[model samples]
Target: MSHTTGADAKGHYFVPAASNYSTTLSIGIFLMALGLILKVNAMPEGAWAMPLGAAMIVYVLFGWFGEIIHENLNGSYTQWEDRSYRTGMVWFIFSEVMFFACFFGVLYYARRIALPELASYEEALNPYMGFTAAWPSSGPMGDPFTPMGPWGIPAINTLLLLTSGATLTWAHWGLIKGNRSHLIWGLALTVLLGAIFLGFQAYEYAHAYSELGLTLGAGIYGATFFILTGFHGMHVTLGTIMLIVILGRCMKGHFSEHNHFAFEAVAWYWHFVDVVWLILFVFVYWL
Candidate 1:
């Protein structure tokens, strides 16, 4: 517990002491997912699960990260450990890329192949009665609904995200240049921009459901629209929280020019979010 280095006297690789963080994290994720499923099915039991799980996750993250921060400040980590962290983050981002790719694939298949194939069938042969294969269509039995247009909030949000990316890059530059004020200001602006983007998205969702008659049940278009955008919004929320934490650290003089992998990791995730949003805007909104 009092060791000054991540390794022991024998110079073995560092292995952290076992903890319940992973177990609790798993439970939290499970409960949250279960709660979503239950609520979507209109079940009343497990109504409290999602919020409780979210609270648990927040608690775990704070406690876990606090311990790690302490360890880092104590000079416990070595170059090997830093390299491992970077490698792990890279793989994690790759997994996320694949996750989104699957959803995008589904959207592509539905739009390009599946819908047109359905359209090719004769009326008598069509199972969907009056189904017309069209982009932004609700299936045959789907209710009448206006599709969302991209020029309004979506366009604005895109600009906000792009600006946030630039601001974050400025913050990184400030960190490297040892300009504390610049770093703090850049991070602050980036976080503000991310918050504004989320706010606009929320308003857009409300408008979609209320004015445009768009919802998950609005069939393929609505489902795909929400699925893609909703997940991206969630990522933005997480990224904003991470930025806020980084801002707090910056104010406290936590990172040096050469030793800020945590900041770099968050920056990587933020940039990934920005790229994903650009693709989403093009394929889901513009197209």
Candidate 2:
């Protein structure tokens, strides 16, 4: 595949001729998502599918990333390739932004438009079903599940993420300045902060489920709460892993002052995740 003569004398951008990781990754993701959907919807027969998919993807991820990192370490990427990587990462982040935007939009529709209309029309017109115009709707069960506030663990998690962002920026600056020690320490701290943030989030989820009676079964409020924060937590986990990889590369003396697109891409993603959490904290938790 690499020997294929796709480019001619005309000015055309070069692309790697051999890569099959993308299709495999897509298949892994489809399996994971399908299994998750089935499991979340209470399909007992498919309970093990998500774990099976996750295990397969974990294996594939290790192999796939090993190949890419090996290529990067081998100095296979040129300036044009770096630019392509940047463009691709930007588009990927944009897609993630859209994904979170849809979830947030669902929250808005449920709280502002749908709930009010349901309460106004259904409560008055139907007279049999008791519907209320509430931000966290009681649904048919009328169980007033407690909503989490921004004061306690949520606030602490917010602080941790913000600090992680700052630490990441510090690491980037250290990289630009060619300070290996500073870079490694800053990145290590950032990963630590991210881990701590996830710890708090896990505790919060458990508290919500047991103490507050908030769960996936708690209707729209719980669903949005878990989905938004849960997704963000997953991103944090990915970002932490990315940072750990960067830390390892730093120790191996892999990245230079100018040639570190991988670090920059992960930093961009981590900052985006931080910003999303701030929005989540403000609207979902406090409001």
Candidate 3:
């Protein structure tokens, strides 16, 4: 005799369907809208407004991730879905790499070609007298741009973020080993380090603006410095929030060795941010 499993009255699987894809797409659209709105605003406080909107995006991501974890724990995902996720992550990282490459290219072109031509113009050339061209300098021409000192808080922040990267790797290793307590502790330490890095960055920005006269509108140097480092700071904020959500899920026992894609993705993002900051530190601040 052959046996058949009973389905629901509607002829569907007994389990409730997971809405992971719909939720992810909806949250992504909402975040994009918020970011665009903040970017187009002309208010005097628009700078702060952008960061506030970014925080809202992070809030949406946390909720959306919760749904994903719920679905995963409920056995809603299949092997094919897991493969799709990995492919999606690869493309996402590729896009981020391109994004940073654009900024770095602009920096290179400005310093190596555009600035020199502008400085040599007859009307502008005499402004700095006989000053020689050098990267990271002030006074509108070939003069060495006087950046705020590099060895103080900026250096300290470098150490903090680098250490956070190490701690996050430890957390990943703990997760792989199935050591729940160690994983939680490692994640907690990474978050704390990230917060400290942000705090020190705030202090350094204040000093740059108040004492060193390094405003975003100062010149090409200041503009590029702020744009590069500022965007990286925003990423750090997002990464920290991602870690907090992962920690919450860990506490709830949401992940397993074979199905921890969400945790691994965030860890990858955090490490990417860490590496970018290292380049920013050397090029924007120290050089």
List all candidate RMSDs to the true structure: 2.2, 3.5, 5.9
Model 2 bad stretches (over 4 Å): 1-19, 30-52, 122-124, 127-130, 140-142
Against the true structure, candidate 2 reaches a TM-score of 0.87
Candidates, ranked, TM-score: 1, 2, 3
Q: TM-scores of the models, in the given order?
A: 0.92, 0.87, 0.78
lDDT of 1 by residue, 151-201 (tens): 988899999999999999999999999999999999999999999999999
Summed backbone clashes in each candidate are 0, 0, 5
Deviation (Å) of 174 in candidate 2 = 0.6
On lDDT, the leading prediction is 1
- Candidates in order have lDDT scores of 0.90, 0.84, 0.76
Report the lDDT tens digits of candidate 2 across residue range 1-287: 34212233443444455666677677778778988888788887457777777777888788878877776776566665677889999999999999999999999988898777766764447553766776666554545688898899999999999999999999999999999888999999999999999899989988998899888888888888889999999999999998999899889998889888889999999999999999999989988
**Cα RMSD for candidate 3?**
5.9
List where candidate 3 sits over 4 angstroms from the true fold. 1-63, 121-132, 138-145
Clash number for model 3? Answer: 5
For candidate 2, the 10 contiguous residues with the lowest summed lDDT are: 3-12
TM-score of 3: 0.78
User: Which candidate comes out best when scored by TM-score?
Assistant: 1
